[model samples]
Structure formats: C-alpha cells, structure tokens
Target: MASVGFRGDLSQAFRARIPILYVESYEEHRALAEIAAVARDPELVRTPRALLTWSPTSGLIQPDGTARRGAIDPEDALVAALRTEEPSVFVFCDLHGTLGPAVVRLLRDVAVAFRAGPVPRTLIILAPALHIPHDLEKEVSILDFPLPAETEIRALLDRMIDDNVATGRITVTLTPGDRERFAKAALGLTLHEAENAFARAMVDDAVLAPADLAVVHEEKRQAVRKSGLLEFVEPHTGLADVGGLENLKRWLLRRDGTWLDEAAAWGLPAPRGVLITGVPGCGKSLTAKAVAAGWGLPLLRLDMGRVFSGLVGSSEQNMRTAIRAAEATSPCVLWVDEIEKGLAASGSGSGSGDNTGTGARVFGTFLTWLQEKTRPVFVMATANDIARLPAELLRKGRFDEIFFVDLPTGPERTAIWTVHLNRRLSRPAVAGRLDLTPALLTELTKLTDGFSGAEIEQAVVSALYDAFAQRRPLEREDLVRAVTNTVPLSVTQAERITAIRSWAADRAVAATAPEDWDMGTGNGRAVEF
Candidate 1:
C-alpha cells in the first residue's frame, strides 16, 4: 500500500476541517513546498487556499511571500489570520517551544472561528517534538512530517550528481543498482540531509563509487545518535569470525538473501527473526551483531531502559517512534540485547497491575508489531533467561526459530581457541613466533574444560598479560597457568546451567552441530594442557 504523501495527507486533513495541524518536523522548506503544492492543486482542496507562512524571526508573511507590517509577534499573526478575507493556510513554523496560554487561547479562538467561518483557513503549528496542551489537546490535530522517501532521496542524489558533473568537478560512475543502493542507504535522512550526505560523498576524492556507501551509513547514524533509545553499532565481524554454531550460522545464511527481490518473487516471506537464548557468554549477542554484518544491513540496538519513560504515555510514543525509524530504514536488523529483561516487566504492561501495566502495554505493542510488521526489519533478540521471556514471545509464528546457545563442546572449544589464538598471534609482531597447529589447539581446548566462549577468550587475554609481564612472547606455559588460575562459570553455576540445558533440550533448537551436542564423550576431566 502506498503511504500518504505530504500533498495527499495535508490536502485530506485540510479538506476534512482539521482546524489546527501540529507538524513535528525539521524540514521547514519541504513542508512549505508541500503546503504550496496543496494550495495550487484545485482537486487537493475544495476551495484553493492562499499559502502564508509565519516564523517568529520573520513574523507573518503574505501569500506573495512578503512580510506583513509589524506582524512579528505570533499573536499578531493569529489575529491577522482570523481577519483575512481570503481562504488561507497559516503555516506557523517552530511555535511549539513558545506555546503558552496566550498563544493557545489565540489558537483555540482561531480554530473555533475557522470551524464556523465559510472560508478554508488552517492554523498549523510546526515543531520538532509534540507537546500539546491539555486545553487544546482535543481540538488540535497532530501529524508527523515524515522523512523524504527513497524516491525523493534518489531525486535529490541525482540532482546533486548533475550539479557536480556539470561543473566537471566530480566524477560519477553509478550503475542502476548502485544508484538504487545509494538511494536506499539515504532512506531515513531528510531531503536536505540526504543532499548534504551525497555532496559530502561526491566531494570526497571526487568519486562516487560503491565504496563510498559507508559515508552514507556514517552520516545516517546521526538519526540513531539522536534517538537515545536506539544505538547504532558497527559490526566489523561476520559469520566467519564466529567460532562455531554451524546450525545457527547455516540457518542465517539461508535467510540472508530471502528478503531480496528474487526471493520475494519466489513467494517467500522475509525471515521474521530468531531468539538466541542460553549461557550468558556463549556468543548470543555476538550472533546478533554478526547476522547484521553478514547480511550487509545496519544494526540498531533498542535500549529498553530508554523505551520505558517515566512520563506516562511517552513510553508508547517512544516505541512508535523507534518502530517508525526501524521501518524507515527497512531491510535492517533491530537487536534487543537481553530482551527478556525488557519484556519481563511487560507482565506489568497489561495496565491492570500497578503502574497500570505501562511496561506490559509497551511489550504488547512490540509483540504485536513483531507478529504483523510488513517491513523487512529482522529482529535479532538475545536473552540469557528464556524462562523470563513472555510466554507469547515463544509461541509459534512470533519468531522464525528459538535457538539455545550452549557451552562450547570439545571441537567447538578447539575451534574457539584456534580462532582467538590465531587472531591475536597472527598480528605483525607475534605471527612468526606463535604456533597455531591443530595439536596446540586441541591441548588449549582441553585446558578450558568447563569454560564458555568468553571464558576461553579471557584465558587467552590473561596468558598474554602474563607474557607481557615477563617481557617475552606468549608461551604454552603462560596459557596453562592462566587456565589453572581461572575458574569457569559452568562449575560455579553448574546446576543452573544444567537446568537451562534441560529446559532447552525440548523447547529450543540446538545452535551446535549434532556432534558438538555430544560433550564429555572423548573429553577427560583433567586439564590436558
């Protein structure tokens, strides 16, 4: 379904006698252009209205774009709007910050007058955020001026390219797919912001290659930065960086291109998401990050703490904003780390409990969206306590699969050790001296008997520190000492780990291979290293 464009939406709202429209936006010029478009189109408005703009800096402006005499104050502008004989649309720009009783009264008065009057005049209040007064809440209309669509962003990019190429200052080598990709990259940016980003890329070494797409991602991160609830993470590691979990990795790889046009043509719905729950440090969160990187999508972390606002009703709004942002940047991954922690409060979300189930309502909103969202926004949620997650979250159709991440088995541990040691030892200064043979990896793996992947990595780090203190290269003895000195979580929380494993054996799919599931078959209790 096509979304309501500015011209269509504004026209519909205006024609429907929506007295006062409060638009939250940063693109003032684009909004003005939309208003002008609405005014000029005979079919858009029943009786074409004259477009007039009002800003505190410039006061009230006439239909011809000329300033009115001494109409600087917003009060004067509202009075003039009420008195005007011609049907007009008074576009009030950025007046929300200064909205007070006096301004609100004038607005209410104008709204009543416009509703009664035969002329078609509208008082639109423009601001970056929504802050409606209780008095005017029922009367005033609120709308969001959405970011420019990909088509608009693409047009802006093409114009920028044409402008630069005409001067012979920048080189342009964009294929049709390249242009589509670039337009898609600038998806969430405003028209002006997209232009600025494109200009920055074109001027950078005077080239606009596929390599320059990173510049767009870098610039678009500003949106996530402003949203205190969602954080943009750079996922440098791919599936290859993950030591094991071949089952999980293979599942993800199969869904990697399923969201593409070809897969859609094959009548495949985009892969919804997966829940990775298990041991605390068994690469649950790492898999979330790696999936986004491997799929060539941006990763946005939803900070649940921020989503639960102290202000009533704001939590719902915040959730909606986050959802809008994620959809706007479609075909992206939305990662919620330790998701169970956020939704557990959702039991409180139903509104019947204390706090009126505000938290529960928020989770309800998220859950409903997860089940129904049409956008290709794959949710990669990680949780340690699957038991704490809402029962509905694990039901069929909520997620593609629920995979349980367990402690590394013998070979998985060996692979994990090899990955860590090689990554550290393959460095320029240590590559020559370090021996990353299969025998050494097997010995190191046995040393980490009950260790999680994180424990193994930490052991490697401790070994490096020991060698650093000795002012010598890392030796097998240092690693062995580190392993002996450290204790793994499996022993300390053995009962809890066993309980989690038992719970997952039937409920969740194993992230490990069939062979990896057979732990302690060939492995001994002693630290072999």
Candidate 2:
C-alpha cells in the first residue's frame, strides 16, 4: 500500500491505541525520530506520551539516555514496558531476528496489557526486514515507511550546498532546474543515501554542477542492483537510434513530461503505460529501451520468470517485492519484455496446468497494481504472441494504448538501411572508402523487402564481415551478396505473420505512420492518428 505521510499514519495509529505497530524499513534512525515526534506532540497523537526505546544491547532506554536497571533482556524489556505507570511509546529496534517463543509470548502479553489499560500506550517494532511469527500475525499492523520524497531530498541538497558554500569547501554551479533534477534523480534513495550521493558529487570535483547528476544516478543504479527482482538498465540508445515507427514515437514524445506538475495543472494525469505487441525481430524491445533514454528516466527490467519460484507462496511474495521495488523507483520506466510468457497461464481458463493458481494470483496482484497504482511507473510491456495475453490485460484502461509493430515498409526499410550503414560506415577505419550513396541504400532496401529490423541489421553486419575477410574496402558487391543470401522471418513464418497482422488490424494502432504504412500489401491498417 502507498504510504500516507509517515507521521500522520503513525499518529493516527497511536491515537487509536494500536497495541502493536510493525514498521519495516532500513532507516532506523529516521523511523525513530518520526515516532518520537508524534509521541511528544499532544496535538498530533491526542496524548503526550514519553518515548522509550529498547535494543538487545541497550535494553530499555528513555529519551534522556537513561536505561532501566535490569531490563537488558528482551523479556525484561517487555515486562518493564508493561509495568510502567505513565503513558508511553515503547519502540523495539531490530527485534525481528530475536522473536523466539519467550519473546513472542512477552510481546503478546505487552500488547494485551497496553490495549486494555486506561492510559494510551503503543508498542512499535522497527526492523530492516519483517519476520512476524504466524501466531502474532493478527496482532501486528504493518506500516509502510517510504524512502525520502523529492521535497525532502531537495531540502537536504539545499542544506548541504549552503554548508559547503559557507565553508568554501565546494563551489555551487547548479541552477534551480538542475537542483530539481538532482532531487528527482535521488527519489528512490533514503535520506542517508541521498546525503551520501550529494556529498560524493560535491567532493568529486570540489564543485557541484549539472554533470554531478551522473554520480547521483550511479548511486541509484547500485541500490536498484541490490534488489534481485529488478534489473537497472542503462539506456545507450534514444529514440533517435530507432529507425522508424514515427506514429509510436510521436505518441511517446507527447506524454514525456505528463508526470510533472505543469501537466497536472492542465488536467493531464500521467499516462498509465503502453503495450507493444508485434512479430518477433521487430523493434518492440528496442522501443522500450529507447523511450527511457529519450525521457532521461531510469529503466528497470522486470523478469517475470524470476518472480515465479519453486517454493510455495514465494511467487506471490516475489511479485509484491518486484512491484514495491518498481514503485520505490518512481518516475521511471518498467520494461517487461515478452510479457506473454509470464502471464500465459493466467489467461487460460484451466490455469494452463498451473494447479497452484500461483500464476493467476500473481497476475491478479499485478493487474490491481497497474490499475490503481499512483506512482509514475510507466509500464512498457512487449508481447510476441498476443493470443497468449490474458483478455483482462487487453481491456481498456490497463494501458493508455496498444501498438502493433509490423515488418518495415519500403520507406522504413530504406531508413533502417541508412541507420545501420551510417552507424558502421561512418567510422573511417570501418568505412574503408565505401560511399553510402542514396542509390545503394534504395537498392539494399528493395533487396530486403520482407526483412524485419533485426534481419536488416544482420545483413549489414554480414556485409562488413565479408569485406573484412577480403582485406579490402567494403564494396557494393559485399552488401548485395549479403542481402541476397539472407532469408527474413516474414519469408519463413509467413502464416504466423499473417495471423498477427490480422489480429492487429482491428485491435492495435499501427506503429508506422499512416502515410508510411504499406497499404498496397494490405499488411497493417492506418489507424494511428
């Protein structure tokens, strides 16, 4: 669940006299400070309570650094909390690992005593990981503690800049816009982590400039890599690298800044996501990568295969973990490549041999999150087999639009040839005096009439290899021979291509522009406006 403000949620729970509150977070100090703030404010919690903290080593300690005598043990700590006369907020730090039977029983006793007492008292358990025993599951309420928001991170950055500038330790060259960009880049990091990133950026060159944003992004990359479920993708190619699909490109470009406040003022909610389904070897995956680069957003690749595990009940947990990680890294793109393979079973009526129904349950969890998620996590999913996709996924509102990528048309093919040729032959060493003339490009495009984008790229690579073997400059003959020797996917899988085209005719908007679509071949419709 999305976190309401931490202080507000904690205060309400305390006011309601919640006996046990479990907060799972890596920010122990921040969590404690928030709790202390709420506990001390009568206006917030409706009752001013003394704050007390306990740890295995520290035992029971008050806010003034005084420890209760003989309360070093877990049981003793709980007993002392129960025996306390004044209304108090008792916080247990890193107690997840020590939840033995004795500790569990004592916790339950404390919960019971705190709830029944006339005075308002609350017990909070703070840990990096949650490990509530089955017996105490009903009694414990999990409260979400999210990473620092953009405003908080921005404040931290401003404070650090002021301090460094006052001491002449570092130069400040960032504009207001650059500061905002830095804060947004550090959105997924905790306050401590953000501080570290800011510090590193400042010290790297004794000055904080716009280029320091890369250092902050590198820090974020490390954090995301630690989460096993999501792979942080470094986009090396932007929309410019993509050869065609002008319609899809235009649609994506229009929604680029919709997540910003300016768009919200215009009554434009952030675009939910888009589904790209097309024949294999087309540019569906490439588009997903290019969009992230073009938008200057971090790209996270979610491997659905990794979400399903052999252990019972772990699949659901994995899905939740993946979703949480994605949400935590907000204002980013989530690329789910080949989504059909992961959700195929969920679409089948008989569960598609998944007797445990784990696939369906996971799918349900994902669908619910996709529909109701408030975070700006743009889901970019691609599918090679539309038939395998669940009908529920294709329904309106799951995605902003569905796009179909077909084999390159004559114009698109020419553009594709030009892109590949220029990318390789532009280098003097690789060019070897070979001129990339317009006539040669047109000839290559005609020779690759039915080739997919991948096929066209391979043909370029093959021609270069042939020239390399001959120890001579790349010649027209080399290119011609490579194109003539290649057999494209549309030739071998003609029936499959026809089936997918027919499916996309009425359902999906063509990726290519209406003018660029090959209407004479009756392949793709001109529905994209």
Candidate 3:
C-alpha cells in the first residue's frame, strides 16, 4: 500500500501542474469517478472532462460523428473540456504508442495555461505499458497498477456466483477452504484470467473443490509462458524417494510448521532459507522439490541464467522484476538449482572481459536483496561446488542453515535402496510376496556403496528395464550386475569428492548423522552439528 501511494504521488505531483497528463488503469477511473461525483467547488468544476484514448480503428469518433483519422487528437478535446466551470478529468485511453512530440507539446501548453488560471483540471493517459520519450522523461510520471488482491478476487467470485444463481444457472458450491484456494491460485493471474478460470471451473465441475485447482495452475502457467524465462516444473520426487540426508530431512521437518503455525507469535523470525552444497546427483535438487511438498507451499524455480541479457540495464531490471514477482506471491519455495554456475558465470570476469566490475555489482545487488528481503520466500539454493560461491553468501543470516549432502551412509543407503526398489516394484512398503527383507536391504546398500541417490535410483530403473525386456521379476543378480557395471561418484571423481567432504566437515552442517558423517576419512564418517 505504501509503495502504491509513493507511485501514485509521481502522477499526482505532475497532475498538480498539468491539466493534460496520462495515468494508467481502472483504479484511476474509479478514483476520478469518486472525486467527480462529490466535489462541488466551482474551481474544481473548471477541470477537464475525462476521455478514453482510442485509435480511429478502435471505433473512436469525433463529436460530429465522422471518421476520426489519421491520429485521433486529444488536444482539442482536452482544451474544450477544461473550458467548463465544472471540475473534470479527460482520459486518453491506450494512447501509449500514439504519444508523440506534437501531442506532448500541445499537452505541455495546456498544462501551463491551466496552471496560470485559478481553475484546475486533469488529463489522464491510461496505459498498461509505460513509454517515456527522451524529451518527456522528466515530464512523464508513471504508476504501476497492481493486480487484484485476494480479497478483491474473493468478492468478485462471490458476486459472480450469486449473479449466476440469480440467473437460474447451476448454484456454486464452494466451501470456505475451496474459496481460499481459489483466491491463492488467482494471485499471479489477472482479473480476466481469474474470472475465466472460475467460470471454467463451474462449467466443468459444477462445484469448486480445492481439487479443481488445475484451472488456477493453468492461469499461472500462462503468466509464466509470457515471462519466457520461467518454466513451471512438475515435481516427481518426495522426501521418502530421496535417499539418506536424515539430518536434512529432520531440519526440514522442524521448518514445516514454521511458515504456517505459532512460530511467529512466539517471536521466531520466519525461516530464511537453506543452502545445500554437495556432490552432483546427491538429491540436492530433489530435496528442494521435496521441501515444497513437505511444507505444502507453491514452488517457484528461479532461472538465474535468464537474468542476464544482451541489453544494458535490462539484466538488473529483470532480476528486480523476478524478485518482486516471487515476493508478491509469498509463502512459497524458491528453488535456484546449480545456482553456483549461474552466479559464478556472471561474477567470474569472463562475462565482463576480466573486469570483475560488472559481476561485483550484480553480486552486490543480489546480496542486498537476499539479506533485506522481508518476503516469506524460502530460498532453496543448490550448489555443486563452493569454490565459486562468494564468501558473502556464506556469511550467517543469508541462509537459515547450510547442509552438505555427501555420499549415502550404510543406514541412509538402506533407506535409499528400499525406497528405489519399492518404487520399482510398485510396493512402497513391505507388502504381500515381494519379499524385500531387512537382509536384502542391507546387502544391496553395502554392495552399492559410494553411490549417490540418483545412481541408486538409476540402478533400480535399469534392473527394472532388464526385467521388463526379459518378462521376469528382477532378481538379486540383476541388482548385482547393475551395481558392478556402474562406477559410483566415489570412483569417478574421487579427489574432488574427498576435498568437498573435507571442506564440509568443519565448515558446513552435515546432512548425515554424527560420528560416521565425515567425508574426509575416505570413508563416510558421521559428524554432528
């Protein structure tokens, strides 16, 4: 609200001097309507009459009812409207692209003439897009109209439902919870989108259940498609599906209720975020998705690569826009997968031709937002290597916790193996006949030692593929062959993996148990927080 007021002031300040000006949106129309309705001052009565700007092609016409062309001039209309004794507002609708130097000059003269008189008038330019010419940069004032709020959407839905019922249409049956979901899903959607989605929901289901949420999600998908950079990912894995990382799982559980419960009332600050830095394919990305599902919050994946652009200043603007969008739709999880690659590329001087200057600037801006942002956007950032991560990001307070996910432990391995095998057999738990006993779980875990969670899942998938081809159930030999044929991360990148575990031993929070979690020992040793 404060931001809206500040932006509104920009237009109001210009309006104080200029009777001919441009503003945006229906909000201005409603505001001016209220003002025009009640104000009775004679000086106010001298204000210009508001008019909507439209091209001659938009069926816009002159008062004389002739074809209005080549450019539908608002100058004569604005000047004549201001001649009245009644205070008025002249609106130029959708004239953003048509605004020119001649029109600007004419508006400027009208503003000067009105300022010299005792009477006041206002000319409003309404556009969804902002266009400021170089010459009118200082003169033009822009205001960003916010999308409809949750309350507004709810009211609109209620009214629409009521009207439909009154018209002998099917009655809308929406519970309070369903109503809340409808409002939440409509957050990023425009008013039209929300209306259409709600209408479609009624047409398809005749009732609004929280399950009818795909319509809302579709609206969000449409918005994301417009951005071009963001891709809405459908998460396939869950916490149980993720191998090992017991410590990380427990930590996430502690935060599950933090966003939705009594934590704030108890004076606990909102959980800031988590930083997962570890070896590749160790469930870093999987954990991010799992956390969102665990917490029952929307997941917004930030594509850092899309922030930089060929145009100057656009990168920073794009970053700000992305941040604002994420913040606006709060109580959500923000996943920045392999963030190190994107940030390092921007900051490594390779982008700026060995000049670290631009990279530093971008990094600084990001750091400030990370620290100062008050939004409840749980940033789940993953990095394969910390060598490139800036020290500033590692400082306390940026992330609520930093967890290092090393190779799976024996017990962690057993859990991972059970999860993968169970998933493969379509029996998540030990059920009738598909005998995956504790002994089989242990043997599989030990045999596939040093494998990441991803590798473990892949092994099970490969065995299942083999079974499918042969028209038989997977046997122990299939599992053994899969393990033997595959070289784990331990053997493939032994030196790098060892160094990472060593760095994480003292410097980071372990995602495994104590006593046996130390990766520096060449064997997975646990180290407690």
Go through the candidates in order and give the C-alpha RMSD of each one to the true structure: 4.0, 3.3, 5.5
Write the residue-wise lDDT of candidate 3 on 139-174 in tens digits. Answer: 555555566667777887888778877887655667
- Model 2 misplacement above 4 A: 1-4, 168-175, 349-353, 426-433, 465-475, 516-529
Per-residue alpha-carbon lDDT of candidate 1 for residues 405-463, written as tens digits (9 for 90 to 100): 87777766877787788888876654445677878878887888779889998999998
Q: Which lDDT tens digits does candidate 2 get at residues 1-529? A: 1233888899889988889999999999988888888889878977799999998888999868899899998888888898988889999998898899999998888889988999998999999988999989988999988788887888999999999999999999987867877887888899998999999999998989988877887787888888799999988899877767778998999998788766878999888899999889888999999999888888999999888888889989999989988877777899999999999877664332578788888899999998999888899999998888899999888999999988777766777777788888777667766788878877887888888889988988898999888776778888899989988888898888888988998899888767756544323323322
* Cand. 1 Cα-lDDT: 0.81
lDDT of 2: 0.86
lDDT of each: 0.81, 0.86, 0.67
lDDT of 2 at 313: 90
Cα lDDT for residue 160, candidate 3: 78
Give the candidate order by descending lDDT.
Answer: 2, 1, 3
Q: List the candidate 1 regions with Cα displacement exceeding 4 Å.
A: 1-4, 163-168, 257-263, 348-356, 426-434, 513-529
Counted clashes in each candidate structure? 7, 0, 27
